[model samples]
Every structure is written in structure tokens, then in C-alpha cells.
Target: MPEQGKKNTLIVIVGPTAIGKTALAVALAQHFSTEIISADSRQFFREMEIGTAKPSAEELAAAPHHFINSHSVHTLFSTGDFENEVLKLTEELFKVHSNLIMVGGSGLYIDAVCNGLDILPDTDLNIREQLNQQLAEEGIGAIQAQLQAADPEYYAKVDQSNPQRLIRGLEFFLSTGNKFSGYMTNSKKERPFHIVKIGLNTDRTILYERINHRVDLMMQAGLLDEVKGLESYRHLNALKTVGYAELFDYLDGNIQLPDAIALIKQNTRRFAKRQLTWFRRDGQIHWYEPDQLTAVITDLESSLL
Candidate 1:
């Protein structure tokens, strides 16, 4: 428990995929005797269990968790949607718990909740549809090139393979005639609670190996079948992710199963690299090896003091 008269705390555990964030968050939640809110955008859909690497039954049971499999793929949940919901949820949770845990690799969603997102003008739906049509016809590379020319700053940071994000960036530029990255004020919002960010990482080679092994495990766990089940929804923005998108290509006869699996591993590694780049820019995060849970707990205690 926090010391008397101290503000409530939100302990955010952020790292790349396959970096053991779920276990660490659960451990911290148990120690603090509080609940956790998941910031993982991929794990928001209940149908994407195998591919998203969601927490196992045992892990979820080990600690009370919110926002894990809390929505359907059909729902269009945005960063702003998440920010509003989580802020409200945190207010309710803080009424009884002094410390709350949020864990995920989605840097944008994390930033949305921690620092309020900049309000951009509503995008023109006609422009958005046109961009989506272009994406469907010319592939991600075409729109990616557009974003690179229009807004190199966000292009450098965004996951280039994600069509939804590419379209959003392109639509923003087309609608406002300004770079999407420029709209981001990067200003921190004052929250009612204190925040402590803990980042877990390890050697890049080791991280890649872990990612490869995890993908293999996912394949064994019926990730292919899970993708098959969602074939009808492949065009949805929710399915425009690394694992699902690669496998969807295989199902469409665009690539072989083996090639698709390999691409998933490669793309996931790239995603991890991008995640590291995003989090590294935030100097507020305290870095540690994934296994350094004891040291992290000690640091958290001292910070709360």
C-alpha cells in the first residue's frame, strides 16, 4: 500500500512483444494488491487470442485484469476511445486501490492515456475511403510512400506495414494540408494520479530469438486456424496487424504457409525494434532487464516514497 497522504500511482509496464511484460505486470499487481488495465491494442479483440499472445488463463487468474479481450474485432476502438474509457476506469479503481498497473507495447495508446492526445479535426470520410481503396488496390507500399513524402516524421515512427495507421496518417495530411506529426503537441496532461513507467528489455539478439520461438509456439497453438476463422474479417482494420496480415496473405494464396510464418517472425522483430525506438525517446521510463523484477519493485517503492 502507498504511504498515507500520497497520491495514487499508475505503474505502467512497457516493452516489446515477447519481452515478458505480462508476467512482470502480474507480479507487480500481486505485490501491490491492485488490479491491472491492459494497454495492448492487439489484445483488445477477444477473437485474436493465439495471434496476439494474450495472457494465459492462469496468468489472468493470478491477478485481476481489465481491458483484456474486452471488445470485439468489429468494434472500431480508437486511441481516443481507449483514453476516455481507461481514465474513467482508473478513477473508479483509484477509489479503492492506491496503485494501478497498465501493461502493453502500444506506445501510442499508452501515450494517449498518460498524456492526452492532441485533438485533430475530424478526417473527411470520403478521403479516408479513397485512401482505403488505394490501399486495397496498390498495397501498403503505395500509401507508405505517400506518407513518407508527406510526413516523414510520423512515417519514421509508425509501423509501416499497418494499413489503418498509414491511411490515418495520409488522411490527416490530405484533410488538413499539414503533416500529421505536426499536430502532435507532445505535451503532458496533468492527471489526478502519479505515474511510474518501467521499461523491460534485453539484448536484441536474445529478443529476436524469443520472438521467433514465440511465433513457433503460436503456430503450434493453432494460430493458423485462428486466422482462418477470421478470414471474412480480414479487411477490417483490426486484422491489419503483423501476424494476421501475414497469415491472411497465405490463406489468399499470395504466399505459402512456411513463407508466411517466416514473414510473421521478421515483421514482429521489426515491430519490436520500432517499439524500442518509440519508448527510448521517453526519458521518463526506467529501464531494466525483464527478470529484474525485484529491483523494479524496490525502485517503485522508493519512487512512491
Candidate 2:
């Protein structure tokens, strides 16, 4: 337990996808007798279960969790919205527990809670509507090319597979003649509690293998059926993600099922690399292997005290 009057500690778990983040988070939350707030934007939508690799019923029942299946895919939940909601939720959770766990591979969402998000200028709704129209009419390639030309830096960092992120980058540039990357000063924001960041990673070969195996498991677990059920909603930004996007391609006859599965593994590997790139840039995070839970708890307890 944390000492009296010690600022509440938010132990943030971060790393590449399929890096055992959920398992580590559950263990830590249980040990600390605290609740978990998921920062993985992918896991927020209730419609996305098998593909998101959400914690199992047993794991969830082991610890009280917040933000898993907390939103609908049909609704638009921006990063700014997630930032505000998580901050308020964290404040409330802190009131009950001195230590809490916030876990995810989504660097932006976690950063939003630890360091405030950049102040974005208001954009014209018409501009957003036009961009959405362009996306629907011209396909993701159009938005990808535009964003790459306008802001290559954000283009390389943002998920190329996600149309929503791509459109946001292009929209920001069109709205203001400034690049989206320019607004990211990374200026630290003060929070009421102390943050302890823990990152999990391993050899790239092993990580890729893990990602491939995970994709195979998702297929065996009926990821195709899940994507099929959401077919009517493919146009939604929520469906523009790695697993769903590739499967949607198969369902649309753009590719065979085998090819779609292959693409899922390939795209997932790329996503994990991007996640590592984002987290590596932050120097505050303590590095650990998935097996180093004991050391993390021991060192973390000392730091909290």
C-alpha cells in the first residue's frame, strides 16, 4: 500500500501489441488491489472483441476494469474525448485507491493522460464532412497520398491503415496551413499524481512470431465471423483498423481469405513496430521483459513509498 499523503501513483503499462500487456496489467492491478483503466483505443468499442484481444472473462473477473467495451463503434470518440474522460475517471478512481493501473499500447492515449494533449485549433465542420466524402469516394489511397504530401512526419507515425487518423492529419493541415506535427511540442502537463511508466518488449524475431501466432488464433476463434457481422458498418472509422480492415477486404472479394490473413499478420507486425517507436521516444519509461513482473512490483513499490 502507498504511504499516507503520497501522491496517488498511476502505473502505466505500455509496449507493442501481443506483448502480454493485458496479462501484466491484470497481475499488477490485483497485487496493488486497484482497478485498471484501458488506454488502448481499439479495445474501447464493444463491437470489437476477438480482434482487440480484450482480456478474457476470467481475467476481467479477477480485477475491476474500466474502459473495456465502454463505447460504441458507431459513436465518434476522439483522442481529446478519451483524454478528458480518462482524466476525470482517474480522479474518481484515485479517490478509492491510492494506486491504479493504466495499460495500453496506444501511445497517444496514454500520453494524453500523463502529458496533456496539444491544443488543436477549431476546424470547420464542413471541412471535416468534405474530407469524409473524399475518403468514401476516392478510397483511403487518396487521403494517404494527401497526408503524406502535406505532413510526411505525421504520415509515417500515424497508422496508415486507419482512415480516421489519416483524415485527421490531412484535415488539420487543410484547416490551418500548419503541419500536424508542428502542433506537437510535447510540452509536459502537470498532474496531481505521480506516473510510473513500465514498457514490455523483446527480440523482434520473437515479437513477430508472437504476432503471427496471435493472428492465427484470431482466425481460429472466428475473427472472420466477427468481421462479417460488422460488414454493414465497415465504413465506420472503427472498422478501418488492422484486423478488421484486412478481413473486410476478403469479404468484399478484394482478396482471398488466405491473403487477408497474411496481410493481418504483416500489418500487425508493422503496427507493433510503430508502437515501439512511439514508446521508445519517451525516456521516462522503465524497460522490462514480460517475465520481470516481480522486479517491476518490487521497484515500483519502493518508488511509490
Candidate 3:
């Protein structure tokens, strides 16, 4: 039997992108009669739909979801903000329900809510201005090199093309004389309730096929049009993401449309691989194939029972 006074457990559905995480999360939430909290970084922005692979209208209507399309592209939000907001929201939800669902591919954001991360010092506006200037002038490679010099270990593991990661790494190294990765200690916090982490995966080939197909679906769903809409904002950090970034190249005539679409699929495959690599390191999570929905729900119910 479950212990008395123990608040409801938080069920986290996490895996690589386009792995049917949102569908699985909605299914689980509907089963448990609870709400969902999105851990996806890009889905928070209202403008990124096709690229982010956000929940469809039917799925959103199937269950109550929070934190999806809640912010604008111009807003400055971080994983830290997500952590704080999710924690508060979960606490409030606990008042009425014992089980809540969170789903996304952003491993860092998921880790933030599951295990509290260190709150770094605020960014100096001047430092940010200087970094932005250097980023634009020197390009992403220069910032990546700077990060490598400061935190070689992190540089090896992080997505080197990501300007936000590179800029933040350099900022922390310059401001505090420490690697940004050093602050990422996965120390578990004392949560008021328990947590059950469920991971969704499949054979590598199957997962890759799913990813390729998903990219195709996104393209058909107006991903190119969406990218064109945000073309002017390509200079922003959010636009530096995979799908949009590659399409921006197409728009700039750097690559043909077909080639750009190919690159999107290729890069998306790579991103999924990285996400799996990140999630695989955690042995505590219960893994399953997306097809094992009923069995997973049964297993989870058994655990909580």
C-alpha cells in the first residue's frame, strides 16, 4: 500500500524529439485524469509550431496542458524560468491530484524539474551586450572555441553549433572563472512528492525512420512557411534551432529547398541521437517502446498502487 501523507507522484515522459512523446504524454494524462506540463524549450514560444512539433489541436483538447505557447519569441525565458514555473505549478496541482505529466525532449529542462539545478548569478547586461557583439562579429565558431578553452569537457558534449550554449559558456567562464558544466550537478532535491521517470525509445533504425518521417510531416505542415514567417528573426537565439536554421539557409539561397529539407531531416536525426545519448545516461528511468502504452500505464499503476 502507498504511504499516507505522500503527495502524488509526477510522471515524466521524456525521450528524443518526434518519438511520439506528446501523444504518449497526453494518453497518460488522460488515463490519470491530470494535466500536462510541457518541458519542451521551443514549444513555449507561440510562433514555433511546425518546427517544434507542438501538440496538435485534437491532442490539446484531449487533455489540459500548461506552458505550451505561453510566451512570445521576443520574451527572454530560460531553463531556470521553466524550472521555477513548473515546480510552482506542480505544487499547486498536487493540491487536487496526485499524478501529473511532463513531457519534452529538452533533457536539461526535464532535469531541472526532476532535480533542482544550481541557480547561477544573473547575467550582466553589459557582458551580454559584449558577448552578442563578439558572437555576431566572430561567428559561432569563435564563441565555441572560447567555450572549448574555458570548458573543454563541456565543449566536447554540448552542441557546438548552438550559439546560446556557446555564449552562455563563455559568459560564465569570463564572469566566474568556471566552466558552465561545473554548475550542472545532478543532485537530487527533497521534493514534497515522489517522481516516476518514463522514457520512450525504440530500435535505432526504427527511431531514425520515425524521425525522418516526422521531418517530412513537418514540411508538409507548412514548416517552410513558418520559417519564412520568422525569417527576419533569424538573428535571434531561438531561430538558431535546427529546423528553422536550416530553412533560413534555404531562404538565403545558400541551399536549394530540397537540399534544405534533406538537411533538416539529417540534423533532426542527429538531434534525436544526442537526446538518446543524454537520456541513456540515466539508468533510473523505466524505458519502453511507444507501442507499449498499455503495459507502461499498467506498470506505472502497479508502482503507485
Scored against the true structure, residue 104 in model 3 reaches a CA lDDT of 91
Model 3 over residues 1-305: C-alpha lDDT tens digits? 22467658999999987788999998998998889999988899998888988899999999999999999888988878888899899888888887989999888888888888886766666776798899888877788777888898667556555688778778887888777788884467777778899999998898889888988998999999999889788888888888998888888889999999898888888878878878888887999998999999999999987
* Residues 1-305, model 1: lDDT tens digits: 45579799999999999999999999999999999899999899998899999999999999999999999999999989999999999999988899999999998999998898997888899999899899889988899999999999898888877788888999999998989998774677899999999999999999999999999999999999999999999888888899999999998899999999999999999999999999999899999999899999999999987
Candidates 2 and 3: which is better by TM-score?
Answer: 2
lDDT of each: 0.92, 0.91, 0.85
Q: How good is model 3 by TM-score? A: 0.93
For candidate 2, the 10 contiguous residues with the lowest summed lDDT are 1-10
Best by lDDT: 1
Question: What is the RMSD of candidate 3?
Answer: 2.3
TM-score of 1: 0.97
TM-score of each model, in listed order: 0.97, 0.97, 0.93
What's the lDDT for candidate 1?
0.92
